[model samples]
Target: MSSFENVTVLTKANVYFDGKVTSRTVQFADGTKKTLGILLPGEYEFGTDVKEIMEIQAGELNVLLPGSTEWITISGQGEFTVPANAKFKLEVKTVSDYICSYIAE
Candidate 1:
């Protein structure tokens, strides 16, 4: 989907990595939540409390998923899933746009 509708977005941004990574919470009617964000070329590590699907809308990046030795490269658009209670690493090569959906275990 190019955009989201019928959702409520929080005004406050979720800032991380000294403002290099920022996202806003988007709440849906079904009680599901997602984050729309941008990553400005940097390395970042994140831990998840729930399963997450990261949809890369635009940009280039390498992802090291939990327990993976390989770094998956995404140049334009891609998607990856991270299990709950796991940590993943990212090396963003360019300004990246993404949507992250949090799923219950």
Candidate 2:
């Protein structure tokens, strides 16, 4: 499998993934959908056709996906995945520091 790692910085908006959404202050290690930390405030929603795995680390992050809209606060790090083609949205609440997220594919 090809390994890919990338970082995304959100200044004033949230990151939307088809139907899966997450806080911008979230980081995924390489190719996993794990969370690194919660850098800011936001909501994550997922569609039914979107499929992805995520991981989080470090600070803290609030996560939201389809079937559930409750906000999840995470600190240090964590991991999760989204289904395929889901309807997702994010609302940037407040952020003291810039949000950094990494993705590997």
Candidate 3:
């Protein structure tokens, strides 16, 4: 979707990698939450407590998903999913914009 309506956006930012990566939580009415974030050119690893669907809006990157020997490349726009309680790696080639939706299931 191009935009989200009637959603609540948290004021506090989620920062990581010494401010190289930052995001804000967006809460929907259905009790689900998503994060809109920016990732600078760098390598980053993240652990998830829930299944996450990452929607890449812009820029380029390579993702190392859990139990994978290959790094998937995402340029401009792409999407990837990570299982709950798993760790994944990302190599951001450029300033990447993404929205990550936290799934309860």
Per-residue error at 7 for model 1, in Å?
A: 0.9
Q: Write the per-residue lDDT of candidate 3 for residues 1-105, one digit (tens) a residue.
A: 699889999999999999999999999999999999999999999999999999999999999999999999998999999999999999999999999999998
**What is candidate 2's TM-score against the reference?**
0.40
Give per-residue CA lDDT, model 1, range 18-98, as digits (tens): 999999999999999999999999999999999999999999999999999999999999999999999999999999999
Cα TM-score per model:
0.97, 0.40, 0.98
Candidate 1: which stretches are off by over 4 Å? none
- Writing each residue's lDDT as its tens digit, candidate 2 over 14-96 gives 54543233353434444334232233454544344336555544445566765666856555555555556555333434441
Alpha-carbon deviation at 66 in model 3, angstroms = 0.1
User: Which is the better candidate, 2 or 3, if ranked by TM-score?
Assistant: 3
**By how many angstroms RMSD does model 1 differ from the true structure?**
1.0
Those runs of model 2 whose alpha carbons end farther than 4 Å from true positions after fitting are: 1-49, 89-105
Backbone steric clashes in candidate 3, count = 0
Q: lDDT for model 3, on a 0 to 1 scale?
A: 0.97
